[model samples]
Target chain A: MAINRLFRWITFSYLLFFSLASVASDELEELVEDLEYEIEDLIEQIDERNKRFKINGFLSAGASYSDSTVPLESTDLLDEVNFSPEAVLGLQLEFKLNDKSKVVTQLVGRGKTDFDIVAEWGYFAYKVTPALTFRAGRLRIPLFLLSDYLEVGYAYPWVRPSAEVYDLAELFSSQDGMDILYNFSVGSVDTQLQLGGGTLARTSPSYGGLTFKATDMITMAALANYKSWTLNANVATVDFVADITGTLLGDADNTFTSNGAGEIKFDHLDILYYSVGAAFDNGVWMFQAEAIDTAYENRPGPQIFPIQRAHYISIARRFNRVTPYFLFAQNRTVSASDRREADAILAQAGVSPFDLARVFTQLLDHTQSSWALGINYSLSPKAKLKFEWKLIGSTKGTVGDFEDFAAFTSILGGQDALDGTNVYNLVFDVVF
Target chain B: MINKINSLAITALLIASPTLVLADLVVVVHPDNSVSSITDADISRIFLKKTDSFPDKNKATPIDQKEGNPLRDAFYSKVTKKDAAQLNSYWSRLIFTGKGTPPKVVRNDKKVKSLISKNADHIGYIDSASVDDTVKVVFTLK
Candidate 1:
């Protein structure tokens, strides 16, 4: 009787335990289903949010070689075949909060800067209306037609923009401020106007890493489009200051210091700049031209600044997937009046004019003309291979864009020694 | 033999049906959209993000077929007058400059039509043959 009772008890306990286990298993499955649904919901939310974000990028990898030892143009290619001078990669991110506003950031890394990434553009844009927009933060100064997209080589027909106009504005590419853009259509023509102002502080690598500041800046830019033609004009002004030291000027530091100028500084200099550009394209043939002039005023020293002008004309003919183009560009700087004023100041200081002639020629007075012949072959819709052979010459002044200006001058002993230079560059540009 | 001939004819017709369908594109909007018809310039402006509203002051959201779609190519070429490379470059300029963004791209005409049919603000282009009562035809490309 005892054995039978124990057997019944064990059987009942086993049945109860099995029922409880089944119930717990059912709950576990339900919990898993609920968790999975929640995860799916979370993923769906993330996917929907991701749709409002975008990533776009552009890259240019190329090598440049110059015939002379001097690093020529803003490319800064020396005699030795080099790859870094012209290579660049950039990435842009945009996040749209809604249809009316977005945030954009562009980071660029250049071979010239040792692949150090820089935030070239970071701005918040708000569309007040369909025709008007307001942007604030770091923005590209609209000083030229391509200033907004200067680093994007795939957008243009040339491997690089014309150095004549770009080199002068390169240092002032972006500013921290706000701009208003108004776009409208008049009949069949489309017009766009941009006005902005900001301050800029940048370090000049060419000047031994000395820093310069520009304040009270203002810019007005306009563009008009009709059929195959586009015309744009831009004007800007700023007050500039540079803290200069003898050591930073390289070879000129000692010469100026020994001449009783302890430390050279340019303060409260007012500068005015303007540019006009036109482009025409009719599928097969394309033409582009731009002219820029910069004038400096309110100088505290006789050697403060000079008037500079630059212009370029380019024509391209597309043959199927390949395009062959030709460009002619000129850059000139005049400082004769400044030189006379410096001479008068030196005369009063018991210093000879001849002692500073080299200094003036090296810094203030120069002329450059470049003729480039190039071909662009579209590898794909987003990429191209470009080859450019440019001839750079000095018309009436020294070759001003070279890197080793003082050394080149000392070796040649005169401004006229550099007649010309031949530079060849092969680049691949892509946009995504 | 008659049955064989019938089957062969059906096969040939089936094989040739895709080519026979014309892909001429038509711009579309929701059935309840306020705008009845749109001009080519207005279509281009909407697709290119130049204007966010229609001529009637209604909010417009432009949708595009994914890149490399023939219908998209035809629509942009005919209306915006830009080829694939030119259009891409143009958008790249605007996007990189923080000026504008391209229209949201869907997979194909059917997707575009479905999306537009669901929202009055949505605008898209589709093949003429894909037009149905759910979406209104705003502009037809020549």
Candidate 2:
């Protein structure tokens, strides 16, 4: 920690000193002349010493609103609508090692949500020439154009993410392995083809007072993009500690076998997303959309988790200063066998978590739709302001939200999922 | 007093109306060049670093006014449909990667008019009202 701090200070002071020197001698003609030369020299040096490395990112700060007469409440007192203190921060570094190889890293830390390091990806790439390039490293699992920038937090259209598409994958879809990318051109249309596979590691857990080590994970994915159309598909099988009834074991790995408790299960998950993203200046009318489906095996205790299906569509119209958008998203994930099996396990476990099973059963019966109304104002190229109001009412009113709309509700038994209760947001974001 | 105020308002309108009219920059090539009219999409393709040459058989060396010029803003808004910051981000992605750089910016109208005059294959934009015999107007912002 001390060494890292010392290094940061040194780099910061060097940057600061040069900036001051540039500013302090601005008016003198001779000094200005020398400064220009110095600047040119320094830029050349940066080019020579640095291997095409570049830094970029964004930051956002905002609040939210609720339709209910009173503002909704949440745990952190951070994301409350009428007023609150929360900051959204993100940063990324791209190191261009050469024409064919590069490294990219990004970090997202938000104040409203617990601040932590999340979504780190790095890979080695080889250009098998301009038309054919191959890369083998952990990639952001190319599901969407926005997927690579998903966690950069400041790179999107919402204060928080759309949630519909952002949360499609339970854990990030990155894997440890190799991929091949081919960029080609036919007449006027640009085409890119990518095919590869990799083994995925379990994300190291460091939050929510409980830790989970994503265990024994492997994945394979294929995707292609021709101009505005994108096709993506991937599947993975992972080992997990099944939800046991009675004990509150801190670590699942050490206790899974010896405790005479829960069973170790293999979860095979398959996901497919096909999207057509197009941009046209139909006189400033822009649109983007993506459709997706997900399937889980053993969702109901390693045997019968049922097939959950969902799709989301979004459209946006831009008129100079204001961009308003409409979105419709849905999920149908109710399985009687899965719910009953979960209940039976919880009822027998004799643990405090049993109470959650009843709520899950109710949620299974309802939750027809999740949609949002949003407005984004491009006050300037450097700054943007966005307001989003989501309507997440359950088909069976008191079902999905744990009987709470105005106060904090534990929507997911996992404890990590956002309290999908009713909430709204006002976000001010910028990228420099 | 009302009469005086009206007179003053009329004078002000006369003074400001020309600037308010928003002169579109007509991006053009020298007259002998083969490419005639270009679509906003083609223009966007060139400016966004998606292509290195014009639709015709010409090597396109792009020229622009200073970074924050209103005419520049108007031109990009018409072609790319992305605001300035968005374009800046797009350019950065290309520039820092050595894939491309934004067109070299000229300081004023005279520089633009002269540069386009010198190269038949070059691409550039200047105030539409500022067009002359030296440059042929091709794509207009509006």
Candidate 3:
């Protein structure tokens, strides 16, 4: 009887253990299901966040070397290779306020400037209709085809845009303005027309970070896209002034003063810009050309009203993952060298006019031409590696945008060495 | 009987050559969409975000397959004449300039059909073999 009782007890305990194990298994499954739901909810939350805010960025790291000590396109390459001149990173943030309105901000950091972050774009845009858009605040001054995305290296084929055309009007990069964009199609061609105006208060980094301020700035642009071809035209005008007290013409002569004032004020100056560009790409081959002219309408001083015309043509062909490109560019000051103002200023300052006249001629009679052969290797769809060899030249006895011309010529013992100088550039570009 | 024979023939062709069927893509819209056909130019214009409406003046929304998909490559090459790199470059120019944005991307042909079938304004491309009654074929790749 005792053996039978022990057997029954063992059977009951076994059944009880099995039931408890099944209960625990059910609870475990429930816990896993709940975790899965929580994970899915988190993913949905992240997706919703992404829909409201978007981020994009681009980076370019470039190294350059030049045979001469002259800076090209603000690149401080002089015999020794320099990496910081072209190294830049840009971040763009787009916050979607609604289906029809958004805010965008872009920040760029440059290695040359010690990686100082600068706000290149901060604007609010509203889509009034499918074909029209309105934007206000700090907007890029779209004077050229690439001017809007100049620092976004992955947008174009070159390590840097041809400096000849892009460098001429560097004073106007952005303006606190309002613009309206109208898009329409004519036959098979897509066209966009932009009209904008505002005041500009910014420093001209290209001109040694001089304080540049403008009023009554007006700009108009047109872009037409037909299949693989894109054509752009732009015109802008501004009444501006710059602090040219320490640099440029004023610095040429220490005794030089404007109206006996300690500093020269480039005030009440009227400037005009005209630009035209065309680009064509057919999967295998690409071609681009742009021409620009900058004219000072008000000639307060003969040396002050300088007119410049520049152009560049680039042709490239793609071979699988590699592309080879060739470019030719030229820049010329169309204005004649008139040293009348310099003579007057020198006479007033009781300084010898001969040296000042020569200085004015050297500075005003600028001419430069360059050619480049470059190859770009696609690291991926969003990245590229480029190597370029470029050579620049000028007319006899001219410096052609090179700073400290007198010292450079004296170091070379003659002006013939300034005729042609070779520059090498290597760049890696990526967009995300 | 003719439709039955055509289906049989297509099944035979698919069984005989899968790569050919893979390249055979059909642009689709919701079944209720009134638009029946699209021209090559209009297709490119819409996909490129150059135009936001169809020929019938109905709002058009474009959807894209994930990057690196061979089907996406073939569709873009045949319709828009743009490769992956070129498209990226084009959109990069637009995005930073605040000009426009590219189309929303889905995972695959299945997701494309699912999305297109749920919205009358949505348009996407899928393999011809995956075409079903849920989505209407607006254009067939030639």
Instruction: Say which candidate scores most in lDDT.
Output: 3
| Residue A246 in model 1: lDDT | 44
Q: Under CAPRI classification, how is model 2 graded?
A: incorrect
lDDT of 1: 0.77
Clashing pairs in 3: none
Question: What tier of docking accuracy does candidate 1 attain?
Answer: acceptable
Expressed as tens digits, the lDDT of each residue in A120-206 for candidate 1 is 989998999878899999999998889989989898989899887788877788899999999887655668999999999988776
**Comparing 2 and 3 on TM-score, the stronger one:** 3
Give lDDT: candidate 1, residue A212. Answer: 87
Worst ten in a row by lDDT for model 2 chain A: A203-212
Expressed as tens digits, the lDDT of each residue in A373-422 for candidate 3 is 99999888899999999888654455565554543454346545456889
Candidate 2 lDDT, A306-367, residue by residue in tens: 34445566667767667787766655554556555645554555534434333333333423
Candidate ordering by DockQ (highest first): 3, 1, 2
Best by DockQ: 3
The CAPRI category of model 3 is acceptable
RMSD for each of the candidates: 10.9, 11.2, 9.7
True-contact fraction in model 1 equals 0.41
Interface DockQ of each model: 0.25, 0.12, 0.30
